[model samples]
Target: MTTLLAARSDRPVQFLWGTNVLVEEAALQDIVRDDVRLPEAGPTCEDLAPARFVTNPAALEEVFLAGMNAVARMDGAPPITSVVVRIQGWREGHGIPAAAESSPYVGWCCLFATPAPSTAESGCLSLADPRAGSDLTAMPGLPWGRQVLIRPVPGALAIAPGWLTHSVVPIEHGQQLVMAVATCSR
Candidate 1:
């Protein structure tokens, strides 16, 4: 696992990302197929509870646990005791809206699949600065008010703080698939 972005005194965002090779190809294929087969709930995307449909639930949970442990170690916090996983398939011209997880949840992790051919602007994850009034001033050599954009890559896994506001860029050409996990410590 790699620390894509580490939280510092100046910048509070802590983002950990890496590619998980432990998940077998068959399992990923199964997940994509299952997501595709699910009925669309809205005009822009399809959502499914992965735990209820995934063929290898244990393997999926193991992946989540790996991310959770990494997050716990980084924050010097207690071990994560719960996770809620969801499979989201986004259609062209649509993406997830900006939002942050509520109380009881400490953070969120996401696993990505190889999306259909698209540019960096399509389906990229956007993490906003959490500091209040940081956007009011733009100064050189400062991390304040800056936004981080992570492009979607196959097998990519990212874990970030729940309080950090985040959103996804719209799919420009093809569909984008993601397995989103919400982590919490009891």
Candidate 2:
């Protein structure tokens, strides 16, 4: 079995990940349906974006608590006071590269839900290893030099090395709603 290693602060950069386990489609829909205006990337609109994070602060708090507990179980680290979840668009650049190897920051997790596809298995998160090689240098604020698509399941989440280059595949045909929250030890 491949065991996950706790990130050493002295490493170039690292991330610990966790999730809230139960983000129902109906709950997502409720947030989207109640929106007065949809999030725009111009012409195209995402039915549900990450804005609902603040809409239900209490729920987020619960998620925060749960996520912290999960992280503590894995890393033996304490919980953080707050986190930020951002709704990302397909065209948005994954910010894995910008963080410098010498930077003192850890990693983040992007939690999402997607419908299963016909004629194929469903709910898989995509990834690109950020530490594959330092051959490719990155600008300050970008994640991977190339794109890595991840499709995680409902009530399921992936906790990979934070600096690992990664992103979500476009939820093209399915009714997928996504939310990404970043957590760190206090």
Candidate 3:
């Protein structure tokens, strides 16, 4: 069954979450840790995309398509075949420092490729209230204060609209391993 997660029932943004354990959790962790090992100044979106990742294509595809389908269900959109999926992991100091933003996708899926830290500051995904609505504003001001926090659970999945003003709180404790899959569809 699908469950809706929102700060307010009237909110325009829809966040859905559930569990999906990978068959080989260790493989996902190895791929991400290797990518983030003593490298770039900060993690970029491209770093998370699947092209740069070294994991089984089937595993990625299985999760990606399942995620897109869930996105379609939430937004009442059509699920088109052939959507690009990307994923990356951000350890402490590698996650988004500040600012919540959106991307160009119907929606996306985020799951723990590896176990996440217990501390909430371990780069958890924080999002503004969806009641802010999805539209360009005359004045660019986000309701950052009205936010909801999603602490990634191992083998769990959270899906939300790309338009939601969301950011990863900087990882302060252990590493937070996340696998994100996005698909751009009109």
Candidate 4:
């Protein structure tokens, strides 16, 4: 029989059965907005929020513990682990690139899907591989965990191996609010 693990929330985003993992969005968002420190990037100043914040220290601790629990189930994977709540908006090539080598941990990209803007041009989320020796033009198909592309519905989650290279398309001048927590390690 398949055993299902319990999550912090009962929302559909918490379900763990897809190309990308999911986490409850509302609660997760509240926790992040109440705790973390969002910074700005120098380059595009768009790679990330370019600016944002994380809330709820206690909740963050819980996320870390949960991450550790996931690592423990990996059998022989490394012990290092981390949990983070990330926020970003529309940008040409956003997000971290995939790794060139293999890692011993996993990553969960919990997309907080809110209401879609009036138009697709308003905001969009896209992902790609980097370590495969690829630039924006030379990138190949979304690597392994990078198969599914989501438009993020507030309260939706997207979790996958941490090594997966992902990015957000661009927000133009509209509002595309998305928050994700990635649990990963070396």
- Give the alpha-carbon lDDT of every model: 0.54, 0.38, 0.48, 0.41
What is the descending TM-score order?
1, 3, 4, 2
Off by over 4 Å in 2: 1-55, 88-124, 128-154, 173-176
lDDT of 1 by residue, 95-143 (tens): 7787777633333333454445457667777766444432324532223
Q: How close to the true structure is residue 18 of candidate 4, measured as C-alpha lDDT?
A: 19
Q: What is candidate 4's lDDT per residue for 7-44, written digit by digit as tens? A: 55664434222133323333466555533332223333
Taking all chains together, each candidate's TM-score versus the true structure is: 0.64, 0.43, 0.53, 0.46
Over 29-100, each residue of candidate 3 has an lDDT whose tens digit, in order, gives 433324433233455333454545545556655555566565666556676464565666666665553343
In lDDT terms, which candidate is top? 1
Q: What lDDT score is found at residue 86 in candidate 4?
A: 42
Better of 1 and 2 by lDDT: 1
Indicate the worst ten consecutive residues by lDDT in candidate 1: 18-27
